[model samples]
Target: MVAVGEILLNALFQVLFDRLASPDLFSFVRQLGGGVDSELKKWEKKLRMIQAVLRDAEEKQLTDEAVKMWLDDL
Candidate 1:
């Protein structure tokens, strides 16, 4: 059986893919001046979530003692 961590990671990856593959994503982004503010806002939110996940994963793999100490506050 697959581990829970693997399952959760897969789920998160799926979410990232779905957000990036949104049908009107690029078009909406390109038309930045044409009332695409809402789409851009949504995109920013998703990007933030993706960044957070990536940051967490990277921190977990750190061998630098100082970096791990800094991540402790997060």
Candidate 2:
């Protein structure tokens, strides 16, 4: 029951996170001329990978106590 709630919350948070780093937002950031957009693109790639891992982990967490603990620490 608790894990279901936690997963739901995490899914919601993931939606917010995915939006914040969207390509359109990054394009806008690039137009602003910070030169940081390139780095942000790099980060977006890494973050995308992390997101994928997290999604898998979140699913795994229901059956793995250690996975749940790891996510809680994050």
Q: Which candidate is the best by lDDT?
A: 2
lDDT of 2 by residue, 4-30 (tens): 656776686677668766889877887
The TM-score measured for candidate 2 stands at 0.57
My TM-score estimates for the predictions, one after another, are: 0.39, 0.57
lDDT of 1: 0.62
| lDDT values for all models | 0.62, 0.75
Q: Which tens-of-lDDT digit does each residue in 1-74 have in candidate 1?
A: 33455457657767776766676776666676775767667766877786676566555646666645544433
What does candidate 1 score on TM? 0.39
Consecutive 10-residue window with the lowest summed lDDT within model 1 = 65-74
**Model 2 lDDT on a 0 to 1 scale:** 0.75
**Candidate 1 — which pairs collide?**
none
